[model samples]
Structures are given as structure tokens and as C-alpha cells.
Target: MSRDTRAVVEELLRRIAEGDHERTAELFAEQLDWRLDWPADGHPAVPWIRPRSSRADVADHFRSLSAHHVPELNGTSVARILVDGADAVVLGEIVQTVRANGAAYTSPFALHLTVEEGLIIRYHIYEDSLTVARALSA
Candidate 1:
């Protein structure tokens, strides 16, 4: 049997938690529609803060994330997940230390994903941009 939408999303999250960005990118469709609900003004200073289209963009986003922050894998937490049909919503928290200033950035996040044929076609992320920006600027 083919993987269901929830399974596909769960696997994607698993790969991300494992810091397997390449594998995560592989889970995305060739023409992905990815959006992080952060201010566009921040993009000039932060590469990962911009919009992403396609798997290569996703990989670049992860690369920028790694370049800017050191994530606390032990502190990462997942609060909840809701999956229906081809869509899934995940609520979680990420703890990261900013590479520039050594400040900690702890933010709760909500991710909305749409999966088709076991590949993620759409990804929308909601998080506290101000907290992240402050950490980066500190």
C-alpha cells in the first residue's frame, strides 16, 4: 500500500528532527510552494526567512538555518498534530542558539503541509519572527 498523507508528513518531520535536510528536500515535490510567515524585510538579512519554491530552495533554507543558528535538538518539542485527508497541521517548539550573538531563541511554531502522492506540495509555517530576529540581532 502507498503511504498516507499523515505518514508522509510524519516522515518528513522525522527527517528534519534528525538534521537530514537532504532527505527532507527529497520528500518535497519538484515544484513546491513553501512559505514562512516571516516579514519579507527580514529576508535581506536572513536567507532562511524568505519564501521558497522547489526542493532546491528548501535545501537552501536549511543551509541558511544551519549557518545562522545552532539548534538544541534535546530541547525540541512537538505539542500536537492534526491530519485530515491530504493536509496536516503540526504544532511544535524549537530552541536554538544564534550563531552571531550566542543568544537563545525559543519559539513555538505551527506548520501546515499539503501532501500529494506522498510528496509535500505545499508548506506554510507560522512562528514568532520577532523573537528570531531579536536573537539574530543580539
Candidate 2:
């Protein structure tokens, strides 16, 4: 029996909210589509705002994110989660304080995940990249 898309997405969110980034990566497929709403060049100051490929990269992404942000000051407020078949869309706002500059930024974001056979095959995120970039600037 395969898990539904909503269940997989919910589990992913649960693991992330618990700050278990390594476990969160386990929800993704070994080799899958990954995208962040940043430029191809990526933000010079934000290390985690780059591209990811495999599940290992996914783990690195979360680890880098945790390392760069002030854990106590990081938060997310999900507006809604819409699931249709194998697709799930999560709408929310992310608030984070940059560890380097101590600047906080809040960006409304939409994350689209495609789960198949209990594993996430597609990860796409759209957010205000400039706001995140500014927060990382000195």
C-alpha cells in the first residue's frame, strides 16, 4: 500500500517543524526534481538558496538552512495545504533571522510537491527571493 500525497506532505511538514532535517529528506526520492525560487546564480550570501539534485542534496539544503538561520527566530505559518491526487501545494509565510547579519525577513511562499508511491518526486518553491537576499546582506 502506498501513502497518499497529502499524508506524505503532512509528514514532511511534521518532520521539518520538529527540526529533523535529516529525517525530512527521507521523504524525497533518491533522484528527483528540485527547484528553489532563486536565480541560477543564486544569492551570494545565502548558501542554502541554491539548486538541489538528489536526496543527499536535499539533506544538505535543510542542514545549510538550519546553519544559516537563527533557529529560535525561525518560524513558518502555513495558510493552507491543497492536495489533488499526487500533487500537493502548501501556501505559507516564512520568517527567519539571518545568522550573519541578525536581520529578519518574512516571505510569503508557495511550495508544490509531487509525491508518488510514498516518496516526493518533485519539489518546487516560489517565494520572494529578494527579501531573503536583503536579510542576508550586511
Candidate 2: 10-residue stretch with minimal lDDT: 1-10
lDDT of 1 at 31: 95
| lDDT for predicted candidate 2 compared with the true structure | 0.88
Clash totals in order: 0, 0
Per-prediction TM-score to the true structure, in the order listed: 0.90, 0.94
For model 2, name the residue pairs that clash: none
lDDT of 2 by residue, 1-138 (tens): 224888999899999888898899999999999998388868887788888889999989899888888889978889999988899899999998988889989999999999988999999999998888888886
Candidate no. 1 TM-score: 0.90
How many angstroms is residue 57 displaced in model 1 relative to the true structure, after the best TM-score fit? 0.3
Best by TM-score: 2
Error of 1 at 126 (Å): 0.3
TM-score of 2: 0.94
Q: Residue 130: error of model 1 in Å?
A: 1.1
